[model samples]
Target: MEKEGLQRSVEFFKHHNINIKTLVTDRHVQIKKWVRENMEDTTHAFDVWHVAKGMKKKLFALSKEKDCSDVSPWIKSMVNHMYWTAASSANLNEDLILAKWQSISNHIINIHDGHSTLFPSCQHDDLEGRERHKKWLKPGSKVYEKLQDIVNSRQMKKDIPMLSSGQQTSELEGFHSVVNHFAPKMIGFSFHGMLSR
Candidate 1:
C-alpha cells in the first residue's frame, strides 16, 4: 500500500508537471527499491524519528538484560546521537553520517579520540560532570560489547546514511495527530463536518 500510494502520488504529480527532488520517509524496503528503479530523479531518505525510535527500543531491551543495567543510563544519549547525526550531517552524505553515527560506540565508553577521520572526536565541549555525561560504560565489558553490536549492526550501517538531514515529516505527523484528536476513526462524521476539520 505504501509503494502503491507513493507511486500514485508520484504519478499524479508528474501528470501535473511537478517533479519531486527528495522524499523523506520511514525505512521501507519496497519503497526504497521502487524509488530507485522507477524514480531516478528523486532522492529517498528515512526519517530520523523512526530510526531513533527503533534504536531506543532495542537499547531499552538491552538494558533490561542481566549485567547490562548500566546501559540504562545512556539510552537517551544514544537516541539523541541518532537525531544529532541526521541533523548535523551536511547534504546527508552517507559516509560522513555513518562515520558520525559510528562514533557513538567509542563516545559512550568515554573513548572519544580517533573515532573517524571525518569526525575525529566528540564535537561538544567536555561534559559537565552530572549535568552532561552520565556514568560512562566500561570498555571490554558485556554492556559495551552489546551496545557496540547494536550501534554497528549490519542494518544500522545501511540505515544510518539513509537518515533524512532536514525538513522531515514532523509537520505532517502533527497534522495527523490533530486529525485524530478532532475526527478519530472510531467516531463517524458527516462529509461537511469531516471536511471542515
Candidate 2:
C-alpha cells in the first residue's frame, strides 16, 4: 500500500509539474528506504510525535529496571519536552536540538543554570515554584542513567533536526477517520458510494 501510494503520488506530482523537495512522514523504515532510493532529490523527515512515541516506549521499558521506578514518572514530561524542543528549534539543526534536549536533563536536576551550551540557564521563569512541588533525580542514579541513555540514543541523535519541525500526520489521521464515516470500512460500497467518498 505504501509503495502504491508513493507511486501514485509521484505520478500525480509529475503530471501536475509539482517539484517536491522534501517529504515529512512517520518513522516507517520501509518508507524511509523507499523515499531515499526513489526520491533522491527529496529530503525525508520523520514526524516528531512518532519519534517521541518510540522514545517513550523505550523509556517506559527502561523504567522497569531495578530501582529505576523514578524514571517512569518522568516519561510523559520527557515526551512533552521532546515536542517542545522540536517546535522551538525549527530554524536550528540537529546539534542545537540535542543541546536543547539535554538542557531538560539539567532542568530536571534543578541545575538549570550553567548546564546548557545553548542557554545560560533554564528558560522557564517559574523554576522556584516548580521546584517546590517536584522531586529531582539525583545525579548518577539508575533512573538518571536510563534517561540519559534514551536522550543520547543514536536514533534520537540522527532524527533530532527532522523532528524539530511541525510537520505531522495527525491531521491526516483525522481525515481518514472522517472518511471512514463516509465509507464505513465494515461494508462494501457501490460506484455511487465510492464516488461520494
Off by over 4 Å in 1: 131-133, 186-197
Q: Tell me which residue pairs clash in candidate 2.
A: none
Q: How close is candidate 1 to the true structure, as a TM-score?
A: 0.89
Model 2, span 90-164: residue lDDT tens: 668667778887787777776878865666566776655644567788889878877877787787777776773
- What does the lDDT come to for candidate 1? 0.87
Question: Candidate 1, residues 104-130: lDDT per residue as tens digits?
Answer: 888887787899888899887877876
Clashes of 2: 0
Best by lDDT: 1
In model 1, the Cα lDDT at residue 194 comes to: 93
**Stretches of candidate 2 above 4 Å error?**
116-120, 128-132, 181-197
